[model samples]
Target: MADNATLKAQYLTQVEADLERNTKEKDRIATDLAALQEQLAVLEEDHALLVGVRQTLVGQAEAAAVTPAEVPVAAPAEAPVETPAEAPAAVVPRARKPRTAARKPKAAAPKKAKAAKAGVAEGGSAATAPTLVELVTAHLTGGAEPRSAAEIGTTLTQAHPDRKIQTTVVRNTLEALVAKGQALRSRQGRSVYYSAPEKVTASA
Candidate 1:
């Protein structure tokens, strides 16, 4: 009977110890599970935030694609309208009927004054100015001997300082007079000399 009691006490003590160890292990696993759950909640919050940002960016891009940019359209150019050829005659008679007869005498007065001024100016200049051809002929006639083109040109240029007489023009006029038989041209060697027809006859 005493051996049976001792064995029963030993088994009861061992069962209590095992029960305490199982309770401590259960508490430790609960703490570990709580930490893991907290970490998972943080990850889920970060995922939700990233997904919201992505959706907002995608929405903006879709909106931009749907809406087009505005462009200004140009106005069309208008073509010019042409009047008929007979339209001027119809318009002129209506516009100028009252003023036509009244304005004619007034317009004619200024035209007559202009014509008088022009006539006086022309007549005065014509009476005073001797022609270049007449001057050249008179110079050749007055000269005693046959003159070279250069000598005649120099004398005429000196006598009339106001005149712009070129030697080439003088030579051309002498040739024309020679052709018309009004002046005589003689050549001594390569030098050409000119005189009036009467002078040439006297010299001969």
Candidate 2:
């Protein structure tokens, strides 16, 4: 009977040791679970923050497109640009042509040197002319039905010997005298003819 009691004691001791080992294992597993949960929480928080940043960047890009200056910052998701808080305002240049060089105004035309002293009137009251006019008169002498301005100018040029009388100048002068009524203008087949207006009264 003593031997049987000793054997029961031994069996009880073994059972108690097994219970302690199992308790230790359970505690270790619970500690690992707690660590894993904490790690997961930290990761989730970081993910959320990254998402907010990304959203903020996207919003800013959209705002820039609208007015190009009214940029906006959104929540997490996209990263935001690291720019200065106070951006410069936009500038617009003035619309005008820049001055480059200096320039002078043109001179006025010269007065004609040898126009008639007395402007002609209607019906030929004879008016004396300047020396060039006398030369023109002598060259066109004989009352021989006035000559062309070109012919008159050529004849005067020959008599003057050293003057440059352009045909255009002569034509202009002859037309001026004709307008003054000192000479008559005659057009025969494109050739212009001029003569001293007859010096006489209209009714005699």
Candidate 3:
């Protein structure tokens, strides 16, 4: 009877140890399953993101294929019309209307008087003003010594302050006079001088 009890006690202790081991194994297995489930969830999210990107790209490509290409059409050219030539028509003279007797001659007379006064003023100024060529010629003749274009321009500007005389214009006029044999052009060193032919002959 004591042997039976000892054996039974040994069996019971072994069963308790086995039950504790089984419980620990079950807990370890549950932890591994939870980690595996989390990995699966991450993989599923990545797969959805990739699928969405691919679908967006495919939709853009489909939209591009559905859109029509724009092409410019040129307008047609117009045809010119030819017309037949006709003979010239005769011109008829219109009848003249007589002037009214009640028309004021005094109003017309004042306008004609103003026009005449303006004409006289313009003619008097035009007659009194000497030409540029005439002035240049008179200056050259009046000067005794041969003068450079600069000296001539200065003298003319001082004498005729109203006239806008340029040195280039004076030089051009001197060159023209030289071409026409009306004036003599002499060069001393690098400076050029001009004088009337009469003055040159008198100085000579």
Candidate 4:
């Protein structure tokens, strides 16, 4: 009878120990599950934010594509109102005075152009100084390689020593020459370059 009681007590103690261990293991698993749930919520919030941004960008792109179609639709409505107003001004004799006055200087323009061309060809004599446009073209065509406007401006600054020249002015002059087909516009990487049309053709 005593052996039976001792065996029952030992079995109860072992069962209690197993129950305690199981409770601890359950607590640990619950804590890990809670942490995983929190991480999943964070990832979901991030996904929602990215989806919102993508939707906003798509909305903007759609709006941009629609806006250009509205321009041609509006242009014809606006053109009739503008044309009559422009027509009278275009034909008025009073407007001709200013235009005739402008043409007077234009007549002398060819003479200056001839002199400038001669100056550029003859290496720019003191008797006939080259214009800013001529000077820019000369500098661009001076080298076998193409030159940037900044470099040309610096060279002009060094050669003249009298006048202050801006790189912007040189750049504008170079563009004007390009528009007139006297100079070639080219790009090397990010920097714009200029050369004489003939040299550009030869290189090509």
Candidate 5:
């Protein structure tokens, strides 16, 4: 009977030891699972940051693609046209209805010259400083070879550092001169060159 009792006690002790080991293993598994979850959270945060940066870059690229830099336009022909002064002083329309003589609007003065004059009064440029158009005309008259808008702008800037200039504005003024028959426009390949009509004759 004593032997039976001893055997039973030994079995109970072993069972208790086994239960303790199982409980420790369960606790270790829970700790490992929690560490894995924390690592996953960090990875998710990094992925979200990368996605945000990528989206920002994509938006900037789209904006750049949508808005491109302006390009200069070439004139229709190289032949010289009648200048504003040389053209007829009065323009009579063929289709206009005849009625009592009406007053005519005075010709508008060049905006560049007007602006330059204002600047001169404001002490921006010296009274002797050339106007934008004059500077461009001087550059055109400098050489036989036609000058591009960029070249003219650079020369003008070098000549008068105080003048604020934009290449597009210069290009538009050149086109206006062409319209007025003061300048000639020619295209060689993709480049457009301009020169005074009188200067073209001299170079020839």
Candidate 6:
């Protein structure tokens, strides 16, 4: 009876060990699966970027290959197209609106509105809506030297205390002043400054 009991106990011990080993194997497999999924995601992103680069290179090559007569011209062609259809087709592309040259790197519009929306400052519309005359009046009223658009924008908030100022507004005001001959632009190094025009006395 005692011998039978000992054999049974050993069998139970072996079963528990097997269960623990199986659990560890499952955990390892799960870890490996997670790693593979992450690798696949990275590979997909890399593939997309590579595809874009390849497409750009392909476009460059195609652009290079065409002879002047067969070439895709941006605006005016020197020679009459061989086929009227082709000329029209070229015109078609233009008609469809060729993207204008990359628009002067458009300094992000120096976005005062977006800054306001993002809570960078207050008086969003009020700052932008001020007319050129009004802005100049306000600028002068603050006892500020006629400052360039940049300098005015950089430090004008301290004086106004009620508006978020932008370089565009200052520039618009300066241009208006220049047009009226009320202010002159001065350049100190690369920086431009403005001061009320040298009080020009109109000739009698």
The lDDT per prediction is 0.73, 0.55, 0.70, 0.73, 0.67, 0.59
Residue-wise C-alpha lDDT for candidate 5, range 96-140, written one tens digit per residue? 422212211123235546865886787754656677778777778
lDDT of candidate 2 over 95-168, digit per residue (tens): 32211111111111111112222333421354433455455555544456657778888877886767787776
Scanning candidate 6 in windows of ten residues, the lowest lDDT window is 98-107
Better of 2 and 3 by lDDT: 3
- Winning candidate number (lDDT): 4
Better of 2 and 5 by TM-score: 5
Model 2 C-alpha lDDT versus the unseen true structure? 0.55
TM-score of 2: 0.31
Candidate 1, clashing residue pairs? Answer: none
Candidate 5 has which clashing residue pairs, if any?
Answer: none
Cα lDDT over the full model 1: 0.73
lDDT of 3 by residue, 164-196 (tens): 998866776666667568888775644668898
**Candidate 5 backbone clash number:** 0
Q: Give the higher-TM-score candidate: 3 or 4.
A: 3
Q: TM-scores for all candidates?
A: 0.46, 0.31, 0.43, 0.37, 0.36, 0.34
Worst 10 residues of 5 by lDDT: 97-106
lDDT of 6 by residue, 37-116 (tens): 97787677545534644554565468777656453563354233224434444554455532232231233334534754
Per-candidate RMSD, Å: 47.5, 50.9, 39.2, 19.5, 22.6, 25.8
* Model 6 TM-score, all chains together: 0.34
Q: After superposition, how far is residue 66 of candidate 1 from its true place, in Å?
A: 79
Q: Which ten residues in a row have the lowest lDDT in candidate 3?
A: 78-87
